[model samples]
Target: MTQDSRPRSPLAMVLLALLAEEPMHAYRMQRLIKTRRKDDVVNVARSNSVYQAIERLLRDGLIEVREKLAADTGPARIVYALTDDGRAALNRWMDAALATPAREFPEFRAVLAVVAITGPDLVADRLAERAEALAATLDVAEREERTSREWGLPRVLLLEHEHLVAVTRAELTWVRGVVDDLRSGALTWDTEEMLASRPPE
Candidate 1:
């Protein structure tokens, strides 16, 4: 899918990811996403979108903005903290994000579409590549967690990091099986049979 077709904003993900931690300043949040967090390794993509995401979150009331007098900047700065409502929403999103893939049903629809497409081998290859990428992403997160733990991030933060890594790994496992099945002739298409099975439509 094109970038536009992707989630219009990583705002939701960004807010939830930050709220996953305690309150932080905008610059700190930006640094957290963009700057090297651990020994020049493991960085979250810190584009201007991170700023935009925070703005949207403030407008949405997902995160409350507190204006504070700053000592270093010589001006008031806004700090963001997750609201109760935000936390509730975060809980819901986390549950959905971490749950098994089929829970979304799109995976199944994609499976059907893969079978529907010609050159199933190519699809299987793509799926395997996707699985590898997903695993690598999760591994990077694991490394981040390890680094963060050593740096003495809050206990809760470390725990959540562990859970997030586990969820990513679980998704990788699911994708691996999907790749295997696609390559193993576990699914197939029979256009004529499907046409016959269909009703008038």
Candidate 2:
């Protein structure tokens, strides 16, 4: 088959991986994501999102309906399995994801670019709040990791949680440092001067 040209969204890639394990219905896939904590990386909060990805994969010929089961009380259940192309695509996506970092435009980074407009004092206060939130997230991730280890889950299985904790800790540390600089007047900026320097629309 020709190389798949569809975008490898996180949701789509994850669905493919789950199917790679075994053929399963959409509900099972969604439940597995939540139960396995893959939802932390994949957005399966909405059931419709999973169905939409399935539809796209079907259109691209990446996945096929393996079977449909008759249900006594509801709509028939459709089981999906990965096509050969889907497995190949999944492997390619994993390789690229691991070897290369995609350019991501996070809202926080965008705000930081023009944060001087908000003035250092307000920015410092907001960043302090953000630091607290990050700390709480880190705490949760650390606790989850400990629980997983206690359950005998291997380090490989908890790598993503480790990444989340490390990134959150780093961000919290950086935010606290910036807050200190702002409070000590080390990072002060002139709002009037900044406004005057803006180019014409």
Q: Each candidate's root-mean-square deviation in Å?
A: 7.7, 2.4
Instruction: Give model 2's clash tally.
Output: 0
The Cα error of candidate 1 at residue 183, in Å, is 3.4
Error of 2 at 21 (Å): 0.3
Each candidate's lDDT (Cα)?
Answer: 0.65, 0.88
Top candidate on lDDT is 2
Model 2, 130-156: lDDT tens per residue? 988988998988898889999998899
* Model 2 per-residue lDDT at 100: 67
Model 1 lDDT per residue over 69-102, tens place = 4767566667778987677666665555455332
Candidate 2 CA-lDDT value = 0.88
